[model samples]
Target: MGTVIVVGAGIGGVTAAVALQRCGWGVTVLERSVTLGEVGAGISVWPSAVAVLTELGVKGIDQAAALSGPTALRKPSGRWVVGAADLGVELPVMIHRAQLHGLITAEFGPGVTVRTGYLVKTVTQDDSGVLINDELRADLVIAADGLRSVIRSALHPQYAGPRYSGYTAYRGIADVRADDGGETWGQAQRFGVTQLIDGRAYWYATANQPAGQGGDLAAVIRRYGGWHDPIPAILAATDTALQNDIYDLTLPLVPFATGRIALLGDAAHAMTPNLGRGACTAIEDAGALARHLQSAPDPLTALTRYDAERRPIATKLVKRSRQIGQLGQLDNPLAVGVRDVLMSVGASAARGAAALRKMKQSRRDHSSAGS
Candidate 1:
């Protein structure tokens, strides 16, 4: 058996470490941060990812999070747009990001060694093994480093960097409680609120803004300040909030590997958060990678198989997520009208419920296939 070195302790890295360790590999995780921390936000785990986590033995999958139905897309004035119920695996569950990270970290035990604050400056590999920071050789090196991956640049220098999606996202956890979870779409902007397991509401807003332009929370409220029920109240009740410019990287529908080193998660295919599949896809990557390694003859062959199995699905998701973001940010009057009309036609309660059933059926089919 040989050692595996995984960079970045984000969701993908930690999950990969645990999965590989179970396969009898000695794993070392190097993280640049001093401590494992996650941005204060909520993440929706789709059924595909829920199945992955359950397989990993992650605890509290259904309880430590809010198990809700799909979000109903509504107008700024609180008028019903269309409920996502028709698209439907229990409408996905929302969990605090840090909690999920902590759950994954707990699975490794003594089989994995995690080193924080050791930023990988460079990487070099040969036929024998891979090296990190000019030293430390390992049979396999996994880069889950994230959007600005040092290993990715070292391996694929010709790759185009992440591009700003011409919008910004504002996130906050509010004290208010909302039972029926959903979102409101205003012109060029959108807002969503969902309850956490602890009963706090995790909310976010996205607006059409240029890259690098920070937002004023007060100003955003004033702009959309007059919108529907609970939104104004939710924004007003927010104790803290932060804004980030949304960006997506160009992920080709190809394998993100070169010999001994391979990329996973955001490093391989960073997508917009529109469909809430970013972390879910990463978890799926971990499962696929683990399954490949467990069955293959060697690490190199296993990585090749992993790349082949994951690239197409992850690439399609990245592209779909970006498209969803574009649709969410439609601001022009004519475009907005058209979008509203489409939503009105597509978002009836019956349609929404049917979508949810179809999503659930897809999950069932996938699970049965995997079994």
Candidate 2:
């Protein structure tokens, strides 16, 4: 079997290692941390990602994941903006991020070996093989090091780092049942809520605060305590909340691969989480790379195909995500009013489409009954 090296032990990295291992490659995953862990929050996997993970032998995610859909957009004063159906998307499967990470890690099986505490300070690709930190060489190198990836910087030094979108997010799991809780968009801020598997609630909010500020729960409570139903309760019920500044890569990489090394996951395209497609796209990259590796003549050819197939799609997604983020955080009153009006009109159109669909189904049922 050929040898492959995967950098970082995140969801994308581990998924890639397992996929390659199943393809009969001896894979080594190098992780900077001594232990495997994920942040305490929820992740929603769209239908596309759920299918890919299931095909790769991971199981029971559907049972564990609560469905996330039928959400309503509301104003901070509790007026309706639109329902989620207006956007025309399939329901995403929601599970804890750590649970998904563990499932991906478990699929490593015996074909892959994981080495911890091995930080990849440098990556260089030679004609024979790619080298990591100048100590180890493999036929291929997959960089899944995350948003501030050193490998990415090495590949394109001209690329500037992540751009802060002038927003900070607070995430936490609250031991409360909030069924009608969805997203609320106000002036320069937004709040969202969804249910977890065990009847708990997963809530998140983005604000116009400076990056890396407001790392306390009281601050969150002060800002949103009086907004709407369940928001105050969720915050008050939370034991603690974790905060992070939202940053995304604005500049698109022309090509996602160079020589023997290829980028994956956030390292490749770190888009905003506005569409909830960031992780789904990363998982897609794993499946795509694995497919090409099995079909191509060699590792280099496979990397080239992976780059060609994934780059354009990811770049387009990055642009869409940015647009959504900008629209969601609009502070101007007139702009927000226009957006709400359009959303209201779109919701009407969506409802009309749904009624048409139901009518067609009813006709089919009646015809079958008459037969």
Candidate 3:
């Protein structure tokens, strides 16, 4: 079996380690942080991500995940722009980022060894193998190092750093009693609320701002306080919030692979959170890397195949995410009103279609009974 080293201990890096080890490869995960953890906020593991975790036998997600009922998109005044029926998500589960990260890492066990505080200054690769920090040598290196990846910088020196989404976000947990959660849109800003498995509520807000400008949760709440019922209550109940300026790898990577190394996760495609697909895509990348490696005869070819397969879709997602962010942060009053109107019209049309389909089905059932 070949040996592979993965840099970073993020959800993507840990996931890749497990996937590769399962495919008969010796795996080592190198994390810069002494301890492994994620933000206290929540992330939604969509059905696609759920499938990936199930395939890899990752536990705790099913037990710890909070299954959501109906969600909606609404105006600040509580007018529903679109309901759950319009944007049909069959099974969406929300879990704390730190919790999910812990569960995924636990699945690795002794099969994969994780070395903390081992940050690689540079990675050099020849035709046969790559050397990390000039000490460790492996048949392949997986750079899941995240948005500020040293590996990514070494490879693409000409590329600028990540592009900001022109918005700042705050994530926190609140004890508010909210079962059905949704997003409320204010001009140039948005607030999302969802239930967590621990009987708490997870809410996040985004507002138009220049890069790197952030404030306390109270300040953020001040901007969105008068929106609706649950918004003020949820913020008031929250104690602390994680504030940061959102950024994405809007500039696409040329290729996901070079020689014996492959970039995974945010290192490859750091997308905006509007789509809520960043972590989900990384999980998908890990699975795809393992699948491609199993089929290919050599690690280089496998890495290349992984690149060809994953890069296109992830790049498209990056673009899509940014577009969604732009739409959500539109400040123009005319534009905001127009967007809300269009969304309402669309939702109404979907409901009418569903009703018509139900009526037709009932008629068909009656005719069959008569027959």
Of models 2 and 3, which has the larger lDDT?
A: 3
Q: Could you estimate the TM-score for every candidate?
A: 0.92, 0.95, 0.95
Q: What is the Cα-based TM-score of model 2?
A: 0.95
Give the residue spans of candidate 1 off by over 4 A. 84-90, 251-254, 348-371
Model 2 local distance difference test score: 0.86
Off by over 4 Å in 2: 360-371
lDDT (Cα, 0-100) at 154 in candidate 3 = 92
lDDT of 3 by residue, 1-371 (tens): 68899999888998898898888888988989888777658998988988998899898788999887579998888888899988755757999888999888788856688899887998998988899989999999999999988998999898885988889998989987677688988899999999988888999899998886778887877888898888888988999988888999857565789888899999999988988889999999999999999999887888889998999999899998899899999999999999889888888888898899999999999999999
| Cα distance off (Å), candidate 2, residue 108 | 1.7
Model 2 clash count equals: 0
Candidate 1, position 70, lDDT: 52
- Model 2: how far is 180 from its true place, Å? 1.7
Sorting all predicted structures by lDDT, with the top scorer first, yields: 3, 2, 1
lDDT string, candidate 1, 1-371, tens digits: 78999999999898889888887889999999999767668888888888887898877777677786357888888888775654334578889999988888878778899899898999999999999988878999999999889999988888786878888998888888877578887778888889888888898889987788788678668766798888888878887778888887875633577899989999988888898888889899999998988899987888899998899888888899998888889889899889888878765756766768889999999999999
Clashing pairs in 3: none
